[model samples]
Target: MSDDHENQYHYTPTLWIGILFLVLFSISGILHILEALYTRLWFLLPTVVLANIGEIIGWSGRVWSSQNVFANTPFLIQICSTIIAPTPLLAANFVILGEVIRRLGQKYSRLSAKAYTFVFLACDIIALIVQAAGGGVASSADTDGKDPSSGGHIMLGGIVFQLVAISVYMLLATEFVLRYLKDRPVRPALVAAVGPRTLDTRMRLMLFGLGLSTLAIFIRSIYRVVELADGWDGRVISTERYFDWLDGGMITLATFTVNIFHPGLLLGRGNRWFGKHIDASGTSSRSGTFAEDATVVEPKRDNGPGAKV
Candidate 1:
């Protein structure tokens, strides 16, 4: 490579993108707190927080790399975190899909919601492991030059698997939605029992938010795969500014948007929606026993004080 080309290829992390992701992750923490309170699902909160942390780390590493292109530590850290950030988001999506399936009735839906959840999460876990291992291989190598070696193969295969998983998830989700809509009668069983009504605007909005977020995340993953496809020689790494907006900023916005308009957050006040209950402390409880906890049941007949009791 020419000296001028080498100089141009010198490493520098994008500070602006790093700061943006930091702020985004910070806000994600706030949502995590709210989600914990609203859903009372303590386990979920940490996952969300962890995902945000990964994003923060990834962006911070990018910023460091911008200043010191030769810094291997930050590069390794960023690569690992970037690969893992979406895992938490996938977890969140799983919960949402599960809730939808349950509401639509287990018997009516052909595919098991729980099964889908398991499969999606399992794929994510596998992808994470592969990517993590690949990151290790890349870091331990003597030089950063692209080698069609085992490490590159691992990274490439892991990314390809991630892309496939994301695609399958989208396809399944679309199928579920289409089936749900088509099967839904003008008077659905639950609606008929409760009262006739169109789709609730609030619920619809939550669904839309989830769909949008999922699409954004899928898009971001594809970009990463392309960016890393040719190893370091790829134009994606050199065109740092484009990726800053395309991957970092867009992903941050998507993550925050989904959390803010999550089904539990938007519909929590209603005891009947999304299998949640708002406790006095402002936390949402994921207890399906909301009817038992909140409902006031009256006797069917008083019988005039038991009539000669």
Candidate 2:
């Protein structure tokens, strides 16, 4: 476990991947900021931007490292990026779970959404701090890769905590879907819009996608814990380059996919922000229409021959 070994894990990304991720981050940052301002959920905005910034720096470091394998700056940048990447994921989870809870209604859920948000976010914060501190301590240690004091244990603990939080989220999501499916109430309005079977199919797809996102994050957390368990001496731990692809690249792709197929944004024509308000009788002054009363109407169920059961 010499400095040479740690330094050997250098990577240089091709320009396209780096550029694409940068753009993705920029957009993500803007959305988070807009939400913060419009909705007053401010604490989440900087975390989104900072996470992406850290990632960009890490990618830049890789580009630099390609020029000089032993470059300390790039190594530092990449390590710091790894340390901070999960924060944004956690933040997205917070927002997503909250919206899901509100849409599904709090009374139907087994766990209080607010309480779950607080607990998961608290754990996420503690994990971030621990990982950040461990990265600092480990990176500062000698070439032998030995920080007998706190680095290894601290990093491992952080990963464990992250895994725990992610697990709880997945469980909650699964429970939510199960309860919804079991107690599903057919709304004539939904049937009229898309036909009953099609509407059910769409609902199932949306729930599945939401569930898959939670699982993807869980998988990423597990990979990290395994990667860190060996304390830089184990094969997996020493192979930082592999972790970059499997953990970093794959997880980013997963998250991007999650957003792309997001139920709130893609499933319906209306604004997701006002989805929960749909049933309210509040009227729009201009259109004289109830805010949430708009309905979807399907095509005629019978042909000109008028076939009927």
Candidate 3:
């Protein structure tokens, strides 16, 4: 083992685990692509597929590093790809949040669904750019035998920004849920427009999946922050086990969990809540409000007989 190799890992990356993650991410990506195409969810397709691609490439780098731990190329590839991969997945989550808010009714949320998507997506992009740039700088410094602290600090800044954004997003999501539960009217028209009882079950499942995935990504971000803050020769960065469990395991679980509750599978097809409303002239309305021709008879507020409790 070379002296430079001492900075990374005492042993090579676990080859079996690396191979397993590569296979899993590849399979999940293919399935996501097919599902997105079938459902015509163009907005979601690229973000998720690209994220999966990053995972595939990152794991490949890990496999390469296992064979040649002293190679800067594989190490950089693994670091950059893995760190930036989950970012697009986080964007995908933001995209779906808008659709969810729209479906459930915009009145339940403080911001418009479109606004939520736009703001968060922009923030995610900023984080991605900063992190990628930092990774590049660090890799170059490592190759040239220069100090990498500046690059590490840049990466740490990006991670911290992402952490704050996700934290705010979670808070907004919680508020939306609470508001929906408390203020949503129990009108027959609203119920019919949304869907049958099964739709409710699907919505719950989607929420659960989104929550779990968000938690996983958040945990991963914290781990990255800590690892990077400790610098290259820090205890956390030198340990492969922590990387495997906190970084690889969390991301893999997140990607898989989101696949199971994909928006294409859960929100597409006969879900009236997300369906387009057509005006009398046959033009699709972009305002996302109920169509003029559609009759929405609000339930009467009757305290006399059979009033809902």
Candidate 4:
């Protein structure tokens, strides 16, 4: 380690915090993979797994940083990883909310269920690209022993855009829920998935988990904005404690919450699109795994008005 190496960080990245996030994300990731396979939610694996992978790599960088605080390589790794880690997770959230709107009633939603995923994911990708560019610039600046404020500003702007997108999504979700409550217009097909009224309880529980995860992500975004607002040397950015609590803590909470109450755990088997079979009774199969070569047959729609739970 050269003594003249530019120190990119204000403080040594905490060893315990890095280990904690790494362990937590690993656990969450493994559990989610098992749940997804059991529930046959292959489509969700890319985004959800990517988020966990990013967190793992990012935290590993921090652990390395603790060993060599002045290392630019690890600094770059952590910067890029932390900034972009949540984007894929946010994509997963968008898809979950989309499914919620679909099951509840598309009439109550401002946009069609599929449209929400398409639109939000596109925007999420754009934000990710901008943040990636910013990270590159910041890393280059740090290596040059120059001001990284421009890169910081770029990253901050990208994060702010993300926050705005999340805010809009929250508003639309609230509107959809409110409209559903007022109109009482749930899809008739959602009547009975297994027992008489298990569908409603399961859907509501999944929605609750989605909501909590989104809120945690929103809060984490705000923390990042504040941390970067003052540039590379900002007080908030300097504080390891703030990073642990606001940054790592929030992501850990969101990941675990979403996984514990995963839609796959509840709604996956019921949705034919999730890669499982649905029966005429609108009930999910007792057990099954999705195979790449297997084809899914959509169950016939039961149009009859069944009583809601």
State TM-scores per candidate.
0.75, 0.68, 0.84, 0.82
lDDT (CA) for every model shown?
0.64, 0.57, 0.78, 0.77
Task: Output the better candidate (2/4) by TM-score.
Answer: 4
Top of the candidates by TM-score: 3
Candidate 2 residue pairs in clash (backbone atoms < 3 Å)? 278-292
Residue-by-residue lDDT tens digits, candidate 1, 249-284: 667767777777766665453353455556799786
Using TM-score as the yardstick, the better of models 1 and 4 is: 4
Model 3 per-residue lDDT tens digits across residues 1-309: 123654365457878889988999999899878877777777656788889999999999999988888776787788889988999999989988877777765665667767778899999999999998998888878777777678879988999999999999999998887656555433334343332112376778888889999999999999999998988778898888899889989988888887899777776632232435556886654434332212111223224355463
Q: Over the full model, what C-alpha lDDT does candidate 3 score relative to the true structure?
A: 0.78
How many clashes in each structure? 10, 1, 0, 0
Candidate 2 per-residue lDDT over residues 287-307, each given as its tens digit: 112212222322232222545
For residues 105-188, write the lDDT of model 4, one tens digit per residue: 565566766677778989898899899889888778867767767887888889999999999999999888875655533343
Better of 3 and 4 by TM-score: 3
Top of the candidates by lDDT: 3
Task: Output the better candidate (1/4) by lDDT.
Answer: 4
